[model samples]
Target: MIDKVAWLHLHQGQVLSTRSRGKDRYYLPGGKREPGETDAQTLVREIEEELTVALDPASLAYAGTFEAPAHGHPAGVRVRMTCYWAPRYTGTVQPAAEIAEVAWLTYRHRPQVSAVDQSIFDWLHDQHLLAE
Candidate 1:
């Protein structure tokens, strides 16, 4: 399994998502953990790199983890996504680094995300956390 961390920034019932350069699928904005890095460390760094925002590490909250067949990968490969919610952040969010675009996606846009992200959308929808 490919382990990764993701940030969930929900506002007005929409989640912040990003599309990497040359990627067709949008995803929750975060990335894999570097050596010796905690989830919070990885989350803060990833979000900063991908979304041009500074996530408050002290306020990071564990959301949930979703696993599914990896998008744009071999069939047998899978991704285990550990998600978190950052209640506070600084700076305006914009596409940065390898990110090609940024969007506020709702449950209706589920199909545009990766499989693991779709599962995250489903959970959010089931909890009524994601909607138009």
Candidate 2:
């Protein structure tokens, strides 16, 4: 299983998502944790790297976890995504580094994201946190 951390930035009923340089599917803005790094640390770092915004470590809240088949990978490969809600951050958000596009995606855009992110969209929809 590939363990990863992601930021759940919901605003106006849409979530922040990113598409890598050559990828078609969008994903929540975060990445794998480094050695000995906490979830918040990983999230802060990943978000900063991908979104060019620094997440306030102290403002992160546990969102939820989801596991699903890793998209574009060999069959049977799975990914466990630990998600967080970052209420505060510094700087502006933009597509940075390997990111090619940044978008605000709604639940209706589920089909355009990875499996793990689809699960997040489903959950958010069920909770009415995501707009139709």
Candidate 3:
């Protein structure tokens, strides 16, 4: 299992997503966890590395966990995502290493996201947290 952490960053009520350099679909901003690192630690490090901003460890709120077959991986390969919502953050958002594009997508564009990201969109919509 690939344990990962992702952030649901709402900007002007819009959710931020990113497409990796070689990936075709957009995904929530995050990355795999390193050894000896907690979820929050992995989240902070990933967000900083990919978005060029430091995340407040205390501000991370556990959203939910999502499991899905790895998009481009062999059969039986799976990824476990620990999602988080951060209503408070410091610094500007910008694409960094390995990030191809950073976009703020709404509910209407949910189909364009990864399967796991679609689950997140549904959960956000159910919670009345999606922008549209």
Instruction: Tell me the tens digit of each residue's lDDT in model 3 across 18-60.
Output: 9999898899999998899999999999999999998888888
Candidate number of the best TM-score: 2
Question: Can you tell me which runs of candidate 2 are displaced by over 4 Å?
Answer: none
TM-score for each model: 0.97, 0.98, 0.93
Global fold similarity of model 1 (TM-score)? 0.97
Per-residue error (Å), model 2, residue 74: 0.8
Residue 63's lDDT within candidate 3 is 88
Candidate 2 to native Cα RMSD, angstroms: 0.6
TM-score (C-alpha, index-matched) for candidate 3: 0.93
Residue-level lDDT tens digits of model 1 in 1-132: 899999988999999999999999999999999999999999999998888889998899899999999999988999999999999999999998999999999998998999999999999999899995
40: Cα error in model 2, Å: 0.9
Better of 1 and 3 by TM-score: 1
lDDT of 2 at 109: 95
Clashes of each: 0, 0, 0
RMSD of model 1, in Å? 0.8
